[model samples]
Target: MRVTIFILLVFIPLTSFSALRFKEVFYFSERSNFSDSHYRNQRPPYYFPGNFAKEQRVEPKRWGEGEAELMEEALSELLSLPQLQKMFLFLARKGPVALKRFAEYPGRVPGGLGRMNQGDKKIGSVKMWAAEQPSFYVGVTDDFFKYMGHLDREKQVKVAKYIGLHELSHLYDYRMRFSFRDQQFLRATGWKWAWFLRRWENQYVPEEKRRALMKKVEEGEMSLRDLDRIVREQYGLPSFYSVTNPKETFAEVLAAYVLVPEAKDFLRPEIMDFLDGILNN
Candidate 1:
């Protein structure tokens, strides 16, 4: 009896570990192949006069003779503005590399490529320093200007400026919450779990339903198991992955706070109420 019990324990752990290894290998292979194809069509990485560059090589005047000059001027002015300056400084103190990158190339507008890898061309995505060094990278998808072709040149510039500030705010939040070690762990674990959880949450209950569920959990009327059941049956998320981790949840909360001030009603009321409850408690 004793020997059977020991064998079962050892066999189970070994089997689980091997499965995890296989999954990791599969994920890495798929991601690496995707990335190779994605970069194949990219530009050779040249430094333009202004910090921003479009993925395609246009005559640099497709917009007009003075468009590039205007963009640079606008970016310089925005950088010096008090609000932008404070936000940049906050990120810089946390990670110097991201600060330098932003200072050097504050905006990137990819051209002609209807969509970037992760998102459509209408909006751009930014990547901040991961607790490491001196530079940050922000990618602006072509979508930022898709419908704005009819808008005046000045309006386009203003839209870019606002979007840039929003991305910069994300950088600040990242630098504050994650340390070098924490970042390393996250990278090793991969973002698939987080992506999966987010999708699952959006599937069944809709974001609108999460607040009530969270409320129940907080009130002790619903146990963690109950929350897990709702997430699984209603949302179609794997129970283990959905409830076992809190990193993504914390980051989302922090990011929302940074982007939308508490005094404002920029976000949905339910989301704001849920976050507020977490914060106050």
Candidate 2:
């Protein structure tokens, strides 16, 4: 019985949602089975930023699950906060959540992300959002932290929290509106910070090299081992995933903005203003 349950847990975490369903997709791992003791006494690196309740210490509620389940539930609770909720409401008002997609492809091999520093297509929501209607998904393999080299439970929570922050940044890329008949979708220029990231990518990465990078990404060639190289070599970006594209850069910055301690080192002065603008804008 224990063996059967284990196998089910291993393979059943991924529940697919068809593209045409227009319903949100949610796929999360049941990795960690941690208790309140794990984070109840711990402090959140930074306060979740917002106009109201601006300094609240935000952390995931305790659960009797593995590392993966903690990340999944933590994300839900984090997004439920009014601070984050308000932001999502604003985006929903603008684009409206008609046929909006939300899926999770968590890393589950237990050892590594065989190919791609990120994913076979793109890391996180960027790839799905890059689609015709800007569908989005947050991609994480178990090897992510192992590769980014973050296995600590608390740090893992921060990773999950930031994934939410980053993916929402991608959601804002499209304009969702309701027409007389049904709804209309249009492409819009992303945030100013995203544009800045593009310029940075262009300036730092030569055309040929940039093209090569794209090829590698399309081929899922980047690996966890490559994280150190990108982190050490990136031009002021927060994480290697940040270098993937403007959306990723924007999302990563968003993640870093609300972080503290281990992940807080990546924040910059301008990012403070950027974060404020995002919260208030």
Candidate 3:
């Protein structure tokens, strides 16, 4: 599990939503088990931003017995959260919510939280990859049973809910296509198009510092690992991983807003106001 480098909000433990009168919005049911041969010897790819090879070829595997039920429980809790329910519904309307678990590809990608496949068609819902080792990874490494061994029912649900929003928010970003359609969001997060590079660049770092940072990275004067450190130091963003880019920043901010109310104390007023306006709409 990746430890958060920017920890601005301390989570207050809350009781599971099972005790509340919760209405189910998204249903996580078992789908057809995936085999490489079923997809015709070609593994479907999952994607993320940054230089980590944009996407990875993935072979989807069926969730172990009873796993879908556990995931459903977590989804139910997610819907119970007042802050995320409307936004989730708004995003889901754009596409069907599909969840799949896959074998890890050979690489350094740690499968941090989960990934969105975004699928091939531009007009519909995309396939989503859940974490291989389940919620917290705990004592397990790619072993769901061992990960579960470390958590009782309550903690299991809590961990599931925590990751659930982050992954779902990725789907929201994909469905919305914020990069092309939402300039306000991108600008608010401090991302601007660099026509020269033909990609979006983080503007949180001052122009001079950004130029120097890139020069150092290209010349191997600075390690790429230091990139996230600089972004966090300059922007004091919600999370270290969010510093990766704007799409991730959007997801992380939404997840923090929903899961940690205290995040309001730390997030910039513009960000909080933006989230409030969008979610309420």
Candidate 4:
């Protein structure tokens, strides 16, 4: 989560009045691959691995060998979900993202379960970050998977699928540049859809407060404390982590909406309607 805050702090526009540009190509790198000495010798900006000489921008990459097959199999199963299928189709106008699975996500960046970059030439079915130092996207942690070998087959599949749904929801969040849904999420704060154009911070919090929260989390080692406060205050959000921010709220709820039978009651009609509009469009 802190890493996300740092990235935002660096990337935040100088003026709210200035125009913003959206990058269409989203990039993913396996943390292990990026750390490999041979790969690093030829790494592109932001650890993208393809040869940039052919194109000014390093061409995006996809999972290779056994990893590719694993992701394809998992995604094939995941798309069996109706809402997930529609959502990916809407996001991946050009194509599906090149899925690069890391045995463990890298420590350099703060996304708890995943990290994603956005650019828009559609890579195919589109698919698609947190704090203390800032992690987001709840998923199967390294510890969970390491010990997963012991679980019964049925329980193992259940946990893995739940994690996948959470990760997918985050991808959906990245693709939504502007939505009446987000505007509604922001409520009558007098903010508009355009405000979300390049801003990745929570849409609901003021800039100063958001930064302080991020810092407090990192410095105090109190990531869970903030969550406890939110639940204690009773924001009525569907998931405890969803209380982190609007982006997380949508992602967490979307995951629960798809996977948790009880999560259905927590969602509003407009949120689903907005999602439906994206799926159909």
- The candidate that wins on TM-score is 3
Error of 2 at 213 (Å): 7.2
TM-score of each: 0.31, 0.42, 0.58, 0.47
Worst window of 10 by summed lDDT in candidate 3? 132-141
- For candidate 4, lDDT tens digit of each residue in 141-212? 233333322322311234445555556666666656332355654552223334555554433444465456
Candidate 4 deviation (Cα RMSD): 19.5
- After superposing candidate 3 on the true structure, give the runs of residues whose Cα lies further than 4 Å from its correct spot: 1-57, 105-159, 206-236
Better of 2 and 4 by TM-score: 4
Clash-forming residue pairs, model 1: 97-133, 97-134, 97-135, 98-136, 121-143, 122-143, 122-144
Displacement of the residue 7 alpha carbon in candidate 3, Å: 58
- Could you give me the TM-score of model 4 versus the true structure? 0.47
The C-alpha stretches of model 2 lying farther than 4 A from their native spots are 1-74, 80-85, 94-155, 158-160, 176-201, 207-234, 259-263
List model 1 lDDT by residue over 185-278, tens digit each: 2332222233655542332344445666656655668655555445434433322122223344333333434333331233334444544543
Report every candidate's CA lDDT. 0.35, 0.40, 0.51, 0.42
Per-residue lDDT for 1-281 in model 3, tens only? 98879868989999753322222234333332223123333334533223435455333455777766665665667776766756656644643455555444322343322231111112111222323221201111133322322322211234445456766776666656664467777767777878988776777664455566656755667544465445544575554456556777787778767776456656666677778877877
Residue-pair clashes per prediction, in order, are: 7, 18, 0, 25
Overall local distance difference test of candidate 1:
0.35
